[model samples]
Target chain A: MLELKNITKKYGNRTIINDLTANIKDNEIMCIVGPSGAGKTTLLRCISGLEKIDGGQFILDGKQFDPTTSENNVVGVVFQDFQLFPNLTVMQNITLAPELVLKQDKQTAQRKAQELINQLNLDGKESLYPYQLSGGQKQRVAIVRALAMNPKIICYDEPTSALDPNLRDEVARIIIDLKKTKVTQIVITHDMDFAKKVADNMLQVQPIK
Target chain B: MLNYIFEILPSLLSGVTTTLQIFFLTLIFSIPLGIIAGVGLISKFKPLKAVLEFYVWIMRGSPLLLQLIFVFYGLPMMPGIQIVFPRFDAALFAFILNYTAYFAEIFRGGLQSIPNGQYESARVLRLSYWQTFRKIIVPQVVKIVIPSIGNEVINLVKDSSLVYVIGIGDLLRAGNVASARDVTLLPLVLVAIIYLALTAILTFILRRVEKHFSYWK
Candidate 1:
């Protein structure tokens, strides 16, 4: 479970996310939907401890999560840009965190990465880079990368925004399939239909500006 | 030319050890110093940035010949600071300092090109700052900065000759010594040939490195 208490973020004189508070329950698929510049993405970033909240507190699984206090690595993220290691293969990208962070053996990390790749239907694409893949393939790889780490929660920031309609639907199905695993998921997206289909709880964010 | 090469091959070979020493030593020190200086440029602290900026600026702005002379010959002239560094040490020191500044800019540009999202994703994975930097930032920066670094290294091979200005007997100096005594330009031309060969070999190696990094793509 996660609790964001009075999270307010300001850029210069303008407020982006003001006095926003929300709670995310364990195993819940929560989608944050809002118009452009509605602080939805910013809110997701704060929860992931990527952005500093000007005046607020974030508690993850009952522990205070402060980026200032060295935010814990209890969460995983799949960026809209994918952020895949362009110089590395899909397998390398997926296996990197586990091998380096968890000190998992190379064989074990490879095994897990392979399993995730298969699960995501990326069996033959392990040797490919982000540039070589279609948008949907890249998103799938990003999701598997987070899944390989086995984090308690995963966050997506407009992951399907860059994909075509068909690919977006495919990505949405993958997100829905992830929900069956009961991991806490927060997807920030503009696709209301996708949110309705995959999310257990809908959190509509209104821009403070 | 073949006869000339055979004639002075022994002397050139004698200078090889010193050339390699300077080459590897400069690389060993300048590379890490360059990365640190690069990170310092992007530091949030203005003072840190300013100080590192000034360092890169001064080292880069001044001529390497001038810095070599200043470090080896000029600094010894000071009153109380009579011995900042030993005479032989100054050649290595000057070369390292000059190359570090150039390499720093290459590193900085590479680091800047990476999207901010990469760091954010690394944080979400619970990677510590140093961990993220080592695993994510450094590798990518190396890939990006390599071409520039390779070029600098090529220049460094020729720059090794600058040690002669401070009285170190590098290849160029060796050629000078040979030419002065023999009254022929062959040794100097041989020096040019030696430099060109070294540079060509270096270019080949760098191309391989670049290809290796690009392999996954």
Candidate 2:
């Protein structure tokens, strides 16, 4: 289980998330739903170690975990726009971090990438660049890239924002199927319909009044 | 006409050697320095960004000819910092500094053109800063700034003639000598052809480079 205790974030003098608290259980899909500017993305950035939370302590399974340390990638984030490296093919994008940061050999990394590609239904897309892929295909590649790190938690920032209704259903199905793989997920979305379709638990974030 | 061309050819060829030396050396040193400076301009350290911005402003605001004169002649006459550079060294020093500033500004814009998601993505993936820069950022920036850098490179080829002001026996200087001595415009015309030829060749290479980078995007 992951715990967020008194999590606070401020941009300049304005406080965005003030004294927030939440609990996310193992293998659970928790969707944080709110109107725009509710700081859902900011909270995700904090957990992903991209943002430094002003007054928050993360306790993961009874251990004081600091994502900022970057000693270990305990969390992975798939951005909304699917920012895959354009210069690299899909397979290279998926395996780059594993080889460079995790010290995995090229064959070991590519083997793992092939497995993720098959699991995510990204077959035969390995040689394609990000610009060459369709929106849905790019998102799947993004998810596979994140999964390659084998993080304990993976967060999605507005995963369905750019998708059509058909692809939205596909995203929902993918999120539900990922639960079977036993990775905890926190999805940030303003689309309540998507949250309801995929979430095992839901939390609402309100703008600071 | 043919005999006159041959007579000036050897002198002009030596000048071409000098021009090419400065052109090649300037690119070799300045491009790498410019990339670093470009990164520095946008760095989180406000002081560094401010300093580099001021530097680029000063470099761009002035003429390359004046800079060449200053480095070669004016510096040695300055009160305390009377460091004298040989004529060739002074021309090279000034040219490198001038081009480095231009390339830095181009790169700064190129770096800015990248999406915020790219940086965030690298961070979330736990990519080391150096790895992120070399593998992800540099490739995109290079692709984006190629056209702009190509313009500067072509400009550099012609601007190499400015070295003549500092008493460097560059292509322009050699042509001037033969023209005045023989009392004919033929050597000067030959000089113009060589300049055009050099730029044309560089333009062709730049187009090829742009094509090479196009493979991804």
Candidate 3:
């Protein structure tokens, strides 16, 4: 289970998230939805350990998300912008994190990523660079790249914002498919229809009064 | 002109070995150093960033010839501190330091040009800073910095000839020696051809590298 208790985050004078808390269970998809600057993205960052909480507790798998003490508290994140490595091919992108961070052998990582590429229907484009792919294709690649790590939880911030309406439906379908795999996921997005499509549970983030 | 080239070709070919060594060494050492210094310049730590900024400032502001002389002759004359090495060692140090600063700025600009989302995406994937830099940041930075780096590399090939001031007997100096003996100015023309060839070869290599990273294409 992943839990955020009494989490507070402030940029300066303005407080973004104040005493915010939530619980996400296994095999569940939790969607965080709100207006712009509602701290939805910030909350996701804190869960992923990408942003520091001003005060509070973030617990994942019984051990709190502490960069200082934890040995292996892995959280996979997919950014709204789709941070694809421009130099690497699509296959390399999916395999890189496992080879470098998880210490998996090259052949093993390649085989695993190949399975994901085929699963995602990205087989023919395996050797293409990120720049060569369309916006939706890159987003799918980003999703599988996160999946390749086999993390306990996957977090996404505006994953389909870059795609056209037609393409957004395709990505939304993929997110729904990911939910069946039994990994906890937190998605921060403005697309309410998207939230309705994939979310098993929803959390609303309100701007500070 | 054809006859002149045939007669001087042997000696010119021999000098090519030294020229190639200097070019490779400068590239091998300077590229990594440049990336480090570039990161330093952008670091959140104010004191270290200021020091790097000033170092780049000084190196960029001064003439390469003046810096070369200072490294070879001037610094050693100071009372307490001394750089103990051969004259060529001193020259090499100057060349490396000088090119390192210029290359660092090129790297800095390339890094800065990348969108912040790229880094955020890496973090979300649970990649440590070093891993993110090596796998994600460095490759993209290499693509962006190639044109600027290509220009610097071409300049460096010609600048390697500057070692003649410290008596290294590089391509230009060898040409000078031949010119004094033959009194034909043929070696002067030969030096130009050699420099051109070096730049052409460097340009070719960089293009191949650029193609490897052409993800968008």
Candidate 4:
């Protein structure tokens, strides 16, 4: 389980996320839903250590886990726009982190990446660049890229924002399928219907004025 | 006209050789230096950023001709510093410094166009800073700044003519010498044709490169 206790995040004088406490179970899909400016992305960033927690602690498996917003932090994030490196093909995007950070050999990384690509139905699409992919394909490739890092938890920021409105079913199916990987999934979305459809438990965020 | 062209072609070709040398050397050194300086301009370190910012301001605010004059003539005469650079070295130094600033500003603009999400995604993915820079950001920045940098490169070709001010015997200087001695504009016209040919070649190469990057956006 991941425990976030009294997590506070601020930007200069204003507080973005204030004394937030939450518990996320292992191997579950947790959805965060809120209106715009409600600090939903802020909370997701805090969990992923993309933003520093001004106050609070993350306790994992009864040990103090200090994850800073810096190198080799064991959390993954898929941004709203799917921010894949456009210069690189889908295979390069998915294989790069494992090869560079984890020191996996090229063959090992390629094999693993190929597995993820095949599993995600991104098999022949590996050679294609990010801009060449559809919104759904890009989102899947982003997921594969994150998974390549073997992160403890993967967070998605508005995963459906770039996708067609009809593709929420695919997004929901992806989330449910991810449960078998045993990696905790945290998704931030404003679409409550999608959230309700996919969430094992849901979080609503409010910004402090 | 053909006999006149043949009469001047050898000297003019030597000048073209010098022009190509200076162009390639300046281009090779300045671009890497510019990328370093451009990224340095936004660094969180106040003193380093301030110094870079100030240096860029000086380079951009002054005329490149004045900088050449200063490097060649003024620096050795200063009280505390009296080191004299050779004529070729001085001109090269001034050109490199001036162009580095221009290229750096272009790169800074490229860096700015990058969305914040790219950085955040890098951070969360556990890639180190240098890793993110090398594999992710620089490629994108290069794509953004290629056209701007191409403009600078073409400018540099024409601006290499300015070396004649310091008596470096580059293409234009050779043309001027021939024009005066022979009492004809023929050599100068030939020189202009040479420059135009060089620019046409570069424009073709740059267009092909732009087409290559068209796959991305």
Candidate No. with top lDDT: 2
- In order of TM-score, best first, we have 2, 4, 1, 3
Report per-candidate DockQ.
Answer: 0.58, 0.83, 0.50, 0.72
C-alpha-based local distance difference test score of model 2: 0.93
Interface RMSD for each candidate model? 2.2, 0.8, 2.2, 1.7
Badly placed stretches (over 4 Å) of model 3 are A60-74, A106-111, B1-25, B73-87, B164-170, B173-185, B212-217
Instruction: Let me know the TM-score candidate 1 reaches against the reference structure.
Output: 0.88
Q: For each candidate, what is chain B's TM-score?
A: 0.93, 0.97, 0.90, 0.97
In candidate 3, list every pair of residues with a backbone clash.
Answer: A131-B216, A132-B215, A132-B216
For A81-150, candidate 1 gives per-residue lDDT tens digits of: 8888776788888888888778899999999889878889999998887789988888889899898888
Runs of candidate 4 exceeding 4 Å displacement: A69-73
Model 3 agreement with the true structure over B44-160: per-residue lDDT tens digits = 999999999999999999988888888888887867998665767777788888899999999999989888887877666667888988887887787789889989988989888
Docking class of 3: medium
| TM-score: model 4 vs. ground truth | 0.94
Tell me the tens digit of each residue's lDDT in model 4 across A1-209: 88989998888988888888889889888999989998998888777776778999998767767777334546788888888888899999988888888899999999999998988899899888888888999999999999999877889999888889999899889878988888899999999999999899998886566
Candidate 2: residue A174 lDDT (0-100): 93
Candidate 2 docking quality: incorrect, acceptable, medium or high:
high
